[model samples]
Target: MFNLFKDESQSVNSFFLFMQSLANRNLVAEALKVSEAKYRSLLENMGLGVIYLSNAGTVISANQVAGQIMGLPLNNMVGRALTETCSRIVKEDGSVLAHEQHPAMLALRTGKPVENVVMGLFNHAQQDHTWVMSSSVPEFLPGEREPHQVFMTLTDITRRKRVEEESSLASVIVNNTGEGIVVTDQDNKIISVNPAFTILTGFSRQEVLGKRAHCFQSPKNAIKIDEALRNSRKNGNSWQGEIWHRRKNSDDFPCWTTINQVKDATGRTTHHVYVVMDITHLKKDQNRLGFLAYHDPLTKLPNRMLLKDRINHALQNARREGSQVAVLFLDLDRFKIINDTYGHAVGDGLLKEVATRIKNLVRKEDTVSRYAGDEFIVFMEDVSDTKSPATLARKLIETFNIPVEVKGHTLQVTTSVGISLFPRDGDDSDSLIKNADAAMYRAKKEGRNNFQYYRPELTTQAFEKMAVETELRQSIDKRELVLYYQPRVCLKTGNIAGIETLVHWQHPVMGLIPPARFIPVAQESGFILALGEWMVEAACRQMRCWLDERVPVNKIVVNVSAFQLLRSDFLATVERILREHELSPHCLELEINESSLMDNAEHIIKALNGLADAGMDLTIADFGKGYFSLINLKRIPAKKLKIDRSFVSEMLCNSNYEAVIRSVIALGNSLNLQVIAQGIESEAQKDKLIEMGCNLGKGDFYFPPALPDAKNLTKLMS
Candidate 1:
């Protein structure tokens, strides 16, 4: 309390000391000279105008850069209100330039720094010119009543802005193109992908960008694409071609694409662009047209033209390789009798079953074609010797010894085969086919099912088959193709398993069209793959639905043909159907004849193993009918054995057949095989097979072949 006066004196002393310190600042002649020199030097060097405005909004100072930006002299811009010194213009988003809001004015009013705020200045004629990205800074003096100055800096970035805008437009165009477009930088990292690429391939730009272009390749097309890309890069040019690619869904599709490499002036590659167009559908249509031109649509087999081509090619190859090839001409025994009695529908069924058997017996490397209405030609290439051809002929005769079931009837069938060997039987395709055909007639004359080799005198008889193949091609739309199903039964329980699908054809105007009628036609026409796929998908849907209902269902057996089996997408197609219908692999069994397995053993075995691992079962439909060795039979890990029906039908009557059936059963049992006796019509036959320890019997003795939705299926359970 007593020191208050002393404290007031000290405060007064401190204030004078501060004043004296500010007075030492030298804001006089020396300061003026230093500031003027610095200001002039800065103005001359800057490309933009710099301005300083007074607190009252009059220009106090101006630099050469600022004068240039406003298109006015330094003296003219000075002593003028910043707003009046420039003709103000509205900005693009529609904001007006006002004096108080201007950078210099704002700096003066608030005593704070402002940068890159746009303003307008008056030119010589009082017209305003706008300058963008200008800045203002406040200049202050010690002990002053108001801010002494505002300094401004101006720059024109319009050229840079325009370049940026053009670059943005180009980027938009690249991103929106319809063709699948990919851009890679010099380092080969993907820089961009167009919208169409994302849509077609199911990969977003974010997902693929920065990844190398080579990542999209599958092993099937990797080598070709790599070579093409490498070549294109080396030449610094463009290349175009068709390529195979797999989509994100794991489906392989065809694409026509172009690749271009971009290079710099130094001749170094800097970027690459890829344009792709999908061509899967186009290829499919081309294949369809080609198939139609040379194949029979009805049976989906190679017709006479295709057969002749194959035979001619085989002959040429045989001559070049010094190898022997044989042609076996087959004619169905008693095929007309079945057609006359059971109607053409049943006749078609018989023909289809015959085709199935014939397909089963031949090697995959061999070609079996429908020669005519009821005759077939089997071309065996790379035969080890003349004995090989004869052995195959005997196997064909044995194959027909099986019975075909149609409309609840067990019909026994046989085939007459005529054999002709390459280099031994006149060498050329026409002569060999002629000799084989002649030999088949001799077999028919000798007692129908037996075969005879051509002996020069039977040329007229051989010529008869050529006429039949020509007629079969046009017979399908003429109502010549047929459909049939053979009943399969559960081996352990003797319950109806499922039907094994088959097809046949007969011409109304031409009586019975054997498998020789339409199968060769379909195969030649390339319709077989389509037809087989249709059959499998249809059968799968029906049987899978019935099985879903838990109606005492056993696995439905579908046949996979050699053509269908060899397709690249075959597995994917099967998987798609099963997934679509919610069907389990356990509900279906695939019957691949022995011939197909032997022809592509490694791939087929791998495919079968994959299917099996996924829970689908496998069966050999016509056992003891194919050209596989006994060791091959043991090597194939099949789940069931279907005893050919011919043996079951004649077991009681033919002693030789009885012994064969016994041996088959014993061999099957020794291999832990489940044997299903097909064509068990009479009670006597069923008892005989049951006594022989056959696991199950199908045919008239049980229930007739029925649809999966049959109402009376439960009645035959026992």
Candidate 2:
């Protein structure tokens, strides 16, 4: 047993020496086998797929990963042609690649390394394509010029490739969308803008690449939009609303904008996206529709609907202030007659003129609305008393005194105004307007050219005036209006200087009516304009007859109403009348009240200047009563200032009245104007006026106004 152990030990030593000798010469086949096994194990266990191919294109070996990537068994992949195993390989574009273009073949042919060559593999089991990124290296024998085999590494990247493709498509859609899109980073700095953003805002990418999104917002809506964005980000939701945005040119326009937060996997906001669409045209259409609903189409004034709304508001305000609201209902007197005489075109012009006049006379807070067919309603808030409405009514009535010239025809129109006060006549809008309308009918009955308050007793009087208006309308055609003359004796010469022509209504049944009673009715019925023209012609003819009789009168002074003076062709009419009678222009004086001249100062200046230029004398009658500015008085081309009868009649009893008369005379004299006093019924008043440097005087004390005949003129001269 000892000898056997000794032999075994020697054999062991021999084996060790022999292994050592093989190690030293590096020629042990066992060592080569172990190294091959280690390399095989590493290749099989590696995360990457590994394949070994012969230079002839046949697959020599493949690891489990490679077989799995190709959807085949490892043993089945071995010894197979690499090109046949992956015959369905394609480029990223889905086009099939030839065998010679494969990574392994390319590496062998070039004798170099190829990396990251992406290819698609058909998975027969799944019947779908799998994308792989492959890298290959050529293997060469020692001292050989050609590669013997190729080593390839592949990675299954189908999921990553799909994600990249989808991301690229999403980017295209975002860039080309019609709505303006802006993207901002976590810091709220703009990072990207779509093509539509640049187009919509008129800003280029270079101009606003890094600008804050709020930089494009309008000042009016900047704070609102910023708050919305903040709230949206806090809630991790999108905000959508209309906002006003500014363009690069500084124009502000409405836009519908949406802001959305882009969040990460952890639900933390990383970026914000903004989208916008213009809405300017839509807003304009909405506003236009709203305006058209409440406004009148013809005059662009408030219609009945709007008037009612204003009246309600006024009533509310009046109630709060403990003040009164006045509702004035007006109807054009005899408007139909003018319309029938001159056609509807002239009538429309007259109505428009009347509307303008009424608007000019009222306060800014008042509302003047066309009720219907020559009818208008005015609503006044916070009226102090009945005086306010009465004053407004008088001003409105005076507006018709000026003639409205339409297509060469001089038209006169007056309004019969009826007023109803809040809480006094009625409280509500409907009740006030209804009562005011009833009062207006009463005014038409009393006289066509006057105003009346809403009183229970006025209804009967209104019917009576309506009857009188009908009679007055017929009086003009029947030639019942006659001229009466009042002689004016010169205070310095004591000679008849002029005769004032006045209108008298000779109503056949009512007997000889005073000028005040029927004159207003005539003016309201638009008969005043015709009657005025007739008086002018008649006075000129009468003056010529007086001149033929060798009377002492040198001039004929005619009282002109506001209506006659407003006529566009008034100067022409006066000239024609004088020419027809062969009377000199210097012999006719036009007397206009100061209130009438001041009502429309600009237009009146032109008319008065035209009359002065035509060699006719112009006189301002009833001067002190009107609120006339000195500058306007200077603009008026008048030769005479007539002291109002109110001042002259009371001068004897009141020193204040005497002082006013003296001041007026001094003012007229200072301005080189002749002063005349009227209604000097007492010797004391006449003596007081003469002592105040008055230039002319005429009243009942001299002689009562009588018919324009030779005998009355001779008596005035005597």
* TM-score of candidate 2 versus the correct structure, residues matched by position: 0.45
lDDT of each: 0.73, 0.84
**Candidate 1 worst ten-residue window by lDDT:** 118-127
Q: Pick the lDDT winner.
A: 2
User: Model 2 off-target regions past 4 Å?
Assistant: 1-369, 377-435, 438-453, 710-712
Model 2, 146-216: lDDT tens digits are 99999899999999999999999989988888889888987778988989989899998888878888888
Model 1 Cα lDDT, one tens digit per residue, 1-718:
5599889999999999999878867666678889989978977776776666777878887776666667777787678776666756445355675555677677878888888764334345435444367778888899975688877777765556557658988778767766788888976789988898888888888989899887676557744766878777566587888877667777777788788988899988899888888887889899988997777655666778898898888878878889888889898864654554456787777777777777888889888787777778888889897788788788888876766677777777788889988888876878888788788878876867787877876775445444555555554446454444456665446656666655555655666554544564455345667667766777777666556666555666777766665565777888888888788877778877665565545456666777777788877766766666777677666877777888888889899988888888898899998887888898888878878888866786676654444555545432
- Pairs that collide in candidate 2 are 401-562, 401-563, 402-562, 402-563, 403-563, 442-462, 445-462, 445-465, 445-466
